[model samples]
Target: MNALYHCISKYHSIPSGAWDALCKTLTKVEIPRNSFLVKEGMVCNNLYFLEKGCLRGYYNLDGKEVTYWFGFEDNFVTSFYSFISRKPSVENIQALEDSALWSISFEALNQLFDAHKDLERLVRIINEQYYIRLEERFMAMQFKTARERYEQLIENSPHILHRISLGQTASYLGISQETLSRIRSQG
Candidate 1:
């Protein structure tokens, strides 16, 4: 798919043969809204690349679902700790809408990575990107006002407000729904 090609190209130049080989391992899947891709306590064996729709990763905290991140079209979503370590995940990955995705099992991906060093490079770059985004989010929560954080969220993912539920958005922004409502009204 073009999304896969674009992602690889953005991270590093891959040989055509290697790209094709990697693509072959990916399988297309269609998931319904509200379906769980990775449930808490289950090992996440697959890395999913969104072809359409959206997904959210959340953790249950004090009987509340606190969203950590969202993935939209052309983005990748996975319980990285679970996938890499082959351990149970603490987060739940759920579809926000009916979605299509390309997924490859962790075993298959590791095999491909072993066969192609360039794939390892691409994976490292992607991991670093994820880390940077998480760091930015942490800093925003610590230092930025709620309104500023909301504004930055809009700048980073313009369609997020439209696509995800307000409850999830509030969780992601680490605000109460009422607070998010006030921020939205004041904006």
Candidate 2:
């Protein structure tokens, strides 16, 4: 609940009444580690606000898990394309640790946004932030050297190295585990 308030407050000025109303509509749930929140080929019905622990979004590429991104506490996780289009998703969202999350179904979220213009604005800002992060990641993969990427990852999320498994970290960096190990050793 505090996480939602913090996010909304950070993105837009929300009236107290609207904030309370939105909070009332949210459903809080605890998910076990390694459980799928959104599986490939399923429509992503909920927008999750992570309050504790971590989650990852990944896709299968040539029988290998290629991680796209990770979401930690106070972050939002969703299959944006599938959620917005109301179609089946190609990526899978899994809890990396036992997590506490507040979520709302697509229908409920739409109703809230319709009822509160500020909420809609907040959603737009969040989407923009997501897009910017995605663009940065794309550029890093395209233009940055492997060591540079690893350094940037460490700089941006120092805890990731300790929190996530080496294999998962390698996948997220678009590198093989052996290469990641070499990068780590050379540093």
Which prediction has the highest TM-score against the true structure?
2
Each model's lDDT: 0.91, 0.91
**Per-residue CA lDDT of candidate 1, range 50-157, in tens?**
988899999999999999999988787899999989999999999999999999999898899999988878888888988888899899999999899999999988
* Residue pairs clashing, model 2: none
TM for candidate 2 is 0.97
* Model 1, CA-based lDDT: 0.91
lDDT of 2: 0.91
**Total backbone clashes of candidate 1, pairs 3 or more residues apart or in separate chains:** 0
Runs in model 2 deviating more than 4 A are none
Instruction: Give the C-alpha miss distance for residue 30 in model 2, angstroms.
Output: 0.8
lDDT of 2 by residue, 55-83 (tens): 99999988989998999998988999999
Candidate 2 versus truth, CA RMSD in Å, comes to 0.9
